[model samples]
Target: MITLNNKKPVNIYDPAYDKLFENLQGNILKGHGRNFTSHIFLRFEENKKDKVKKWIASFANEITSCKKQIKENLAFKRDRTSGDTFIGFYISALGYSFLENFNSSEKETDFFGSMKDANISDIKPSDWESGFREDIHAMILVADDNLMLLREKEISIRKEMNGKCKIVKIENGNVIRNEDGAGVEHFGYADGISQPLFFSDEIQELETKYKDVKINFSSFFPLSQVLVEDPFLKNEEAFGSYLVFRKLEQDVDGFKAKEEKIASIVGRKTDDEKEEIGAIIVGRFEDGTPHILSHEEGIIDNLSNNFLHKNSSNGKCLFLNHIQATNQRDEASREMIMARRGIPYGIFPGEGREVGLLFMSFQSDIKKQFEATQIQANHYKDLIIGQNLPQKMNLDCFGKKGKEINVENFVKLRGGEYFFAPSIPYLKNV
Candidate 1:
């Protein structure tokens, strides 16, 4: 119900919203980046309920203004560094139950359901390195330019929580920003390219009125598409959003090995030619260039949002191509895509550096947005990708060179959980 328009509701940065803002955490309203990120998952002791509440209250000051988070600190310490790097707090459904009130059995998303139902509990014991298959209560994400600084802050936080909570698992993720094949995922394709535009008038203005490829925001997104309304407060305007955290382990070596085989099958010999073949499968070049009308020649900007498959000829990006397979702009699904906030993760990052994405996304409804996309990516299936093809339910035209592009399950879903980041006001009351 909360919608932003020509009439500004209230600036999200206003001091009056201190309580509400503090309740919301980082990477909810905006995008998050990388350098060095340490993910520490936790499980709280049942006896220390009061202590846990006190610890949550301690974040009151840090969560507001949120100034010194990873991004700001990165700028200040561009040359120097801060021992007190940015910290983000997130909780699983079980953790929320540990809080006072507001834990009345949430079933909004399968993410909050029993772990077994999530199918995450079935991950092989060896893949336990990804963590969280067992019952995980909370997650803390700390990022910094200096690894020492990051570790120091993490150790201090742990020291405070000491006996009250136990560290379930700790994983360190390094950055691969601008290092040759940087900005590219382990699969060697541009990753995190097509994120949804946050629905603000200022942002919408830039995309719609003044731009050449006018975006019909209403057609694509509902007002509350990604906005989280405060269920605790009576005047529940927009408050917080849903966070979907998934640890996707990418098979860099396997993907590369498969790409070469696919290249030969399609007759691409040279490196550049093989790369293009990979992109066709991925839906974009390593630089994030979507290959829709790019082959059509006059259109397809690097930052293009104008291209929709229905407008293109029959089979521009074959029905099963990664990019084409993912694009769902129909009235039912235009708003289903969540805003991606994942960063590439690994100790030593790169094409085959044992890397993967710390896949994260935010949305109003996890079931509608994140789950919808997950369904399509789970398999090429019979999912529709328009190219003026016949309206048959079973997409007969979905393949590469008249043969189905064998989808290599390159990404493994090691672990994940859903959390509702309530508004600061709601948290203050709690």
Candidate 2:
């Protein structure tokens, strides 16, 4: 098992790791921290692999490195101003097949088999949106805090693609904020709270902020959790991480309505008490408070990364809750955790508006990490986001038991694809 610690810090810029960080892509070690993002899915035109390679080589200069990202992050911390637009490039298995003379056998087996062919969980490719059903060879992610600047960047990418590549689909994602000014999903719950910490400063900040709490779960992870060798790059420093992108459409009104029903079934009367029902279903209150930590919401000191589900059988937090099903806080569960960097997209509460989360995660092995977690969630019937059919869950809330309520769908799998975020050096040399 991997040991978890808070004493040691992973200094990415240290002499031993500086070269690796220089070759690694941004948003793998740390997020780009941009508010607006656009994912441009592309397919190379027939007989245009040479032009596509040239475009990729030229665009390699625009890719952000982890070293540069960390410097920008520190500068942002010192001053409120953020750096310029951040960009990321990823290629799918089909993209690799299109480019000649590229060796992909060194990659994980799942990379060669696209997400559409993976048959993950209960997701059906036929049900997916048309845009994702088509072949997507590559994706370009452009992000910036300013929407206008983000649009300009997208336009520039489209213009640069010319006839060499066809833009199959474009997904625009904007960060949705809650009343507390933190990022939240369409269901109004704080998201991305329990991400794996890779850097020394990140670990330090988490430890210092939650020093008083007894942290049962550890968020600290080594670089091996996400980094894998890039087959196309000969340098040992060249590494990359597999990326999983899924578009999950949430039914906000349906979920809230079910929450109300669950609240009434659990015998809660007050609004605050009723809210706890939602927390139980989600494994966290809307304000990001872990349900196992405290019954009430907004306990700022309750470290999200410091809770375990060992007592879940006692009914403090339902076994079928989203968090518990996805992560039971066990030694083996730690290996399955992914560095989630998703952002909510589209407007909510408006008629004819389609809103949901643009889920994105980085991992070393898709099958062992993302797919395993999803399969576990399916078995447990995760009430929030599990793609399984409607099923009943034992609602043992507030010391009550023997009550089973059928939980319906709240999230739909719209579309997704798996791609590899390769090293900047690999792209430049391709």
Candidate with top lDDT is: 2
lDDT of 2 by residue, 306-352 (tens): 66788544447466688888888888889899989888889775567
Give me the displacement of residue 339 in model 2, in angstroms.
0.6
* Model 1: residue 71 alpha-carbon error in angstroms: 11
Hey, what RMSD does candidate 1 come out at? Answer: 5.8
Candidate 1: give the clashing pairs.
19-424, 19-425, 20-424, 20-425, 23-424
**In terms of TM-score, which candidate is strongest?**
2
**Model 1: what TM-score?**
0.78
For candidate 1, write residues 67-89 as lDDT tens digits: 23433535545865433466777
Clashes of each: 5, 0
Q: What lDDT is reached at residue 68 by model 2?
A: 88
* Residue 308's lDDT in candidate 1: 68
Worst 10 residues of 2 by lDDT: 1-10
